[model samples]
Target: MDATLWKNSSFLKLWLAQLTANIGDQCYSFALLWYLLQATKSGTALSLLAIPEMAAGLMFYLTGGVLADRYSPRLLMAGTDAARIVVVISVGVMASFGVGQFGFFLAAQFLLGVFSSLFQPARTVALKSILPLELLGRANGILDTTFRSIRILAPMTIGLLAGSVPLSALFFANAASYLVSVFFVLTIRDSLKGKGGSTASKLTLGQYKRDIATGASELRHTRDLFYILLFGNLGYLVWLVTYNVGFPFLAERMDQGNGSTLAMLMGFYGIGNLLGSLYMARACYTRHLLVVLIGWMMQAAGFLLLTGGPAFHWLAFLGAALAGVGGPLIGIPSVTAIQVKATDANVGKVYAINMLMYTCCGMLSSCLGALWLGKLPVERLFLVSGLALVLLTVVGLAVEKRNHTTKHHSLDL
Candidate 1:
């Protein structure tokens, strides 16, 4: 990792923008969850928030991806941020007026999800434009570590403020964060140049449909990429289930408050992620594919320990740390690989599909885990997650080996 990338004005601007936006997102999430709990006090209502938000985000991702590839990422991101400011302000106004309508909150969340769907793909594509390919891993590591580190402070601060501060204050703060992000994003000149030529002249619903079809066909033909996405999605599923179910269960068993231990464990996890990302930034590796595989394996091992035994409190911390470490190792590489390997014309669609798969799996897993919580032991949930990881790893390794053998044979020919 070159320290020089930090000096690159474009990269610094985008990085700062992302950091600001993420902090605001964390604050909003914490505030909203607290608001929901205060209003309803029902687990079902709180869980439902994830449903519409996740579904709407996934449903729009492909469209968002298409737009990202066809247009300027800087413009797309700025536009989305501007839109979010409106939504956040509106929600803040409604909440300030003592409007406790669940439907209104849900609608606001859905709209935010839609904007997020568009923002993510465009932001991802913009990263490639800012940093050299050789430095992508390091850059991404820095980004992830910063985000994770902030998670430690953001949620608690939001919670503390929730008591005395009006919810509108948090919403206004969120809007301000978006404005700050947009200002920084506007400073990046390269992202404004756009990729490929404008397809607006020929743009139509049919053109989008054709693009999706073409992108899907290309993805289907790329078996290695497909498997990578599949394993990644599965890993997301397991992680989501463990996070949603196992934490509370373990907390109950330990006689600790439901969220206290989990929060502490998460702090340790954040530290681990920071450390792991730092290591990856400096490590010499030809490709991150191996790192992705290893990361998943470690995540699975961590889940096993987290869900394993009553005596495994220490194990839970270790597991959380491992899971955190595994994330950036896999995430940075997988995203960079997709961006580099996919045709620039279809990168948005590919990234959209990737996000949809992961989000859908996570959503589904959360629902299932919620449903199964009463019938399943916490340990069993961990065991199941570990088993799923092991299966995914075995399949990935087998496929990778075959690909290597085929390459060697082709070279001999």
Candidate 2:
């Protein structure tokens, strides 16, 4: 519970590794997008880049989860980090030779996605293994804050670099960052159980199936955790729809609908997110349901304000900030709940499934928003999704309360 979580050398090393890798990935992503736009001048080019990446990630997540549970996360993570370094460096080499084709970039993106899927489950398990139970919440808060902070700055930083540095240099820089992360990962000594047991035997298909089943069984047994995850994923879907699709459309419709205004909106949201992350790192909230409920409501308010309705158009920035603040309120507690409830044996699967659901939600939002954006006004979408989120949050809280009371009454009887 001490706020000085960095005192733990293992956690510090893991955090640094993750930080470096995240920044590098962001830069790589920005560079890829920029290159695609300049080369193709078609929206389909972006889709071609994103869809394959998403598909690769989705296809590998469950397998990654199983591997995370079956093997040493430290080794798995390091290996994947090394693999990505090779992939990125290869791409950089190709770029240096004037081979910046869409197909080449797509291949690199897909490889990165595959490696990322493998890395994520392992990273989650590794973090849990290194950090104590009491510090999970704080560590998660700090990590989330760090990621958000990077997101806020990475685009701008990369944009500045895009003007001065070649895409090949950016790719090489990303590879170098991953190489640094590999060093940090190798330095950490994981005290996780069953470290060397993974290499002892060949895994049969039946065994792999059984491992995945056990993970699913673990979730099925934890009823509260399951419901929380369900609501959390759905909430994420709604948030994604509003933010990704609705925000840009609304911004364009607003007066002075320029890049600067849109950037200001995002900047405000990032500041709020940064503050929220810092707040959660320092303070502990015992009631997760209340936290989630408050977060959803705040998020809903933000979305509604973003609707750009009469007399409320100027308050859109405030809405963005509220949404940012509300996000960590839900995310940190939800992750803590899962980590606390899951056994080490099933933790990897739980985290994997959790990530898969979140990713799928984003995909669903993107697809559905695309379909709806053409037929309806963007403000209506924002308002509806916001209200729906509010309703879902209320329902989730009520269900949890009833379950709590029912269990208590049955115990009394």
Candidate 3:
């Protein structure tokens, strides 16, 4: 658990590339939402932007996982980055010409999602291939911290600049970041070898499907891991619902200006994540599974505070900070566990399934939140969801502890 494990050149390149791309992503997202709001002024229109992306992600992620297992991850990373660059550049040009329709934007997002679905699984696997097992935790910690730090800066910067600059400018910047990411990925020497026996031998579609089924069955059998993954997905759902649906409405209720206050709050949350990641990096314990459970509890408490009453209004920032703490605790360790436990042969498939779970949760939460909008106050929704999360966490901890005790007793006998 040496912190210096993150000093590897390969890890550094990948981490830096991800950091740059994520910053651009944050900037583009805020700018895109602002443009849509100004153009349509309808919640439906704003929500539609998410649909194509989510559908594309859901449709392609499993296939992406299969491909990652079959091909060289370095090549996949480079190619996907290049594809994203083209898509972003096209969006920039179209917007600059005042010809960027909502449909066209949606298409861009969908295509980006397709490429991203492929890129992410490969990227995750590639990091494991590059870093040693012992350093995985530290590498993940650094990676998360870098991404969070960029998120902290990107939104506020984009919000400040969006009014002065055209949306096209943000798109152009995003495109450049992707191209830069490609360069950095290219510099990484580590490449993934196919785990499905010979790369020279091709599998039929049926064979491929069978392999995926086998992988799925293996995942289902790992009961503790499955529950942990489920909790991660549920945590993500709560986060998306609260942040995407609740926060915007709450900002409006508080009479915060469009985008500015939201940006500021996100920055604060990023600060919390940054600090939390740093703390995690120096952490000496190996009981990250338990840490994730505790983190969820902390998040639930934070949400409850947010939902409590007028007296808790002053704690909104604290709530955000606590939620931020929960994220890396869950996200970093959950990923590490999968990487550590999954056989190299099925790593891609496992990671893909994990990604699907989280993405589906996000989509479900957003859809549910959309339905709940205008039906109840945002604070009330937060209260309900927060309580639900607390209960879930408690149950999860109990199950985990029981499993631990049973295993210990079996070993003793």
Candidate 4:
């Protein structure tokens, strides 16, 4: 990791922008989700909120990839933020004016999702350009940790203002954050935005198809990235989806619907995640997959402990913290590998492919989480999650061993 990472002004600007934006996003989500649950009195509505976003990612990720690779990432990022501001403001206006329709909210979610899909690829491209490859892991760590922290603090802060503040306030705050984000993004030097892969006239139908094919080929040939994207992330999916949907239920069952307990568990998880990300930022490694598998194993053990958590409060906090620590272990290395290994020309497209995988799996996991929560006990769900991680870890270890052996034999020859 670069010791001067803290001194890098361009990266700092980007980091600050991301920090403010994520905090706003957290606030908006907390406010809107509460509204939905109150309006519909259905967990299904909460689940439904994620659907349109995933739908947009599925539909637009490829196109977003093409554009990011073919244009100025700086412009794309700023433009996306500008568009988000409008969408968020629109949502607030509708709510303030007494609009009660759920579909209207879903439509707003879909539009925001579109910008998210675009911004994600562009953001990666921008990051790769901002700093050298050596600092990439630490940068990713900074962003991930900030996001996790906001996930913990933002909701609680909103809860504190429940009666004093209006829900529309969250929406407007989110828009303002985006407005600030756009300003920071534009302030970045123009020379830093890497040139696009194709000219406007060259991006014809046949060329677009070829560009997509090229990115797919690049990803298929990248062994580490392919494995992490497919299997390692699958394990992470188990941890993220199950825990998110299960936490409130655990709180309900264990404490007789106490919100404080839920908040406490989340705090432990967030703190652990912060520490793990800091570790990844300072630590160095060439075998990214090993770090990811180790993370999964740690989380698996945490989940196993969590099966006994509801019965014992100490175990619950300990388990949540351990699981939280595993997240950055899996995430930072995977992202760094892409930033370092993927060809510069294809980096955006490759990242888009990665995000697309997340979108598809996210939708599946959301449904499975809802189904499992309805049918299985919370203890059993934690057990299943833990066991699933154990399975993924075993498979990943086997693959790593085989790859190492193959490389050694070829060297000997």
Alpha carbon lDDT of each predicted model: 0.79, 0.81, 0.77, 0.83
User: Which portions of model 1 miss their true places by more than 4 Å?
Assistant: 159-164, 192-200, 256-259, 408-413
Per-residue lDDT tens digits for candidate 2, residues 85-140, read 99988877876776657888888888888988998888777878887787888888
Give the per-residue lDDT digits (tens) of candidate 3, residues 268-386: 66777788788777665455557778778877877776664234545766777777777778888778777776777667788889889988888888778878879998789779878
- For candidate 4, write residues 1-413 as lDDT tens digits: 56687788878888888988998898788878877777778877777787798889998888888877778788899999999999999988886776768999999999999999999888887888888887888789878877877887788787888668888888898999998899888887642544743444567889888888988999999876788777656874676566787777777777999999998888888898988987887787878788888988889988888888778988988998998899899878877877788887778888888888776666677768867767888888889989999999999989988777787898999
What is the RMSD, in Å, between candidate 4 and the native fold over all Cα?
A: 2.4
* Structural similarity to truth (TM-score) of each candidate: 0.92, 0.93, 0.90, 0.92
lDDT of 1 by residue, 232-260 (tens): 66788777878767777876775556678
Task: Return the TM-score for candidate 1, rounded to 2 decimals.
Answer: 0.92
Candidate 2 residue runs with Cα over 4 Å from true position: 1-4, 194-201, 309-311, 406-413
What are the C-alpha RMSDs, in order, of all predicted structures?
A: 2.3, 2.2, 2.8, 2.4
Q: How displaced is residue 268 in candidate 4, in Å?
A: 2.1
The 10 consecutive residues of candidate 2 with the worst lDDT sum are 191-200
Q: For all candidates, what are the clash counts?
A: 0, 0, 0, 0
lDDT of candidate model 1 versus the reference? 0.79
Model 4 TM-score?
Answer: 0.92
